[model samples]
Target: MAAMPPMDDELKALQWRAWHRGTREADLMIGGFFDAHREQWGSQERDWFSGLLQEQDVDIMAWAIGAAEPPARFQGPMMQAMQRLDYLKAPK
Candidate 1:
């Protein structure tokens, strides 16, 4: 397999995507999750999150908030963490 890009560069790209989801709410929910949990992630977690960033923001938000069930691909620990919704800070 080819070498992976430097994680810092990859993570910077992910950060931009997470925080620019076209609406403030999506930005907060997605970006906040990224910020809060990213340090703990390994390759599998990063891959999952990278795939998630490709999903519709409304779908992602719904999954995060428990209003809708995530597809099998998105279920499991990562989604569980997102559902907790504790990472978001109220706007000051």
Candidate 2:
């Protein structure tokens, strides 16, 4: 298997994934959240967000929108932070 990319590269990849999840709604939700919070994130927070990125966009959206309960592994401060949905904005 190929070696894992460096952490910076991994972060960039995560940013890309956040913005390009195949739908505008998912993109806005995930990508907007990433853009809003990534600067404040430490290594642990980054790791948590990275793990979240591995999940399906549909599931992530469901969790974010409260349409479905997030699993225990995804529950906690980081997910709670996301649950706020503060990153979302009214389109001008």
Best by lDDT: 1
lDDT minimum window of 10 residues, candidate 1: 1-10
Name the runs in model 1 displaced over 4 angstroms: 1-7
Q: Which pairs of residues have clashing backbones in candidate 2?
A: none
Which residue pairs of candidate 1 clash? none
Q: Each prediction's TM-score against the native?
A: 0.90, 0.84
lDDT of each: 0.93, 0.86
Q: After superposition, how far is residue 61 of candidate 2 from its true place, in Å?
A: 0.9
lDDT of 2: 0.86
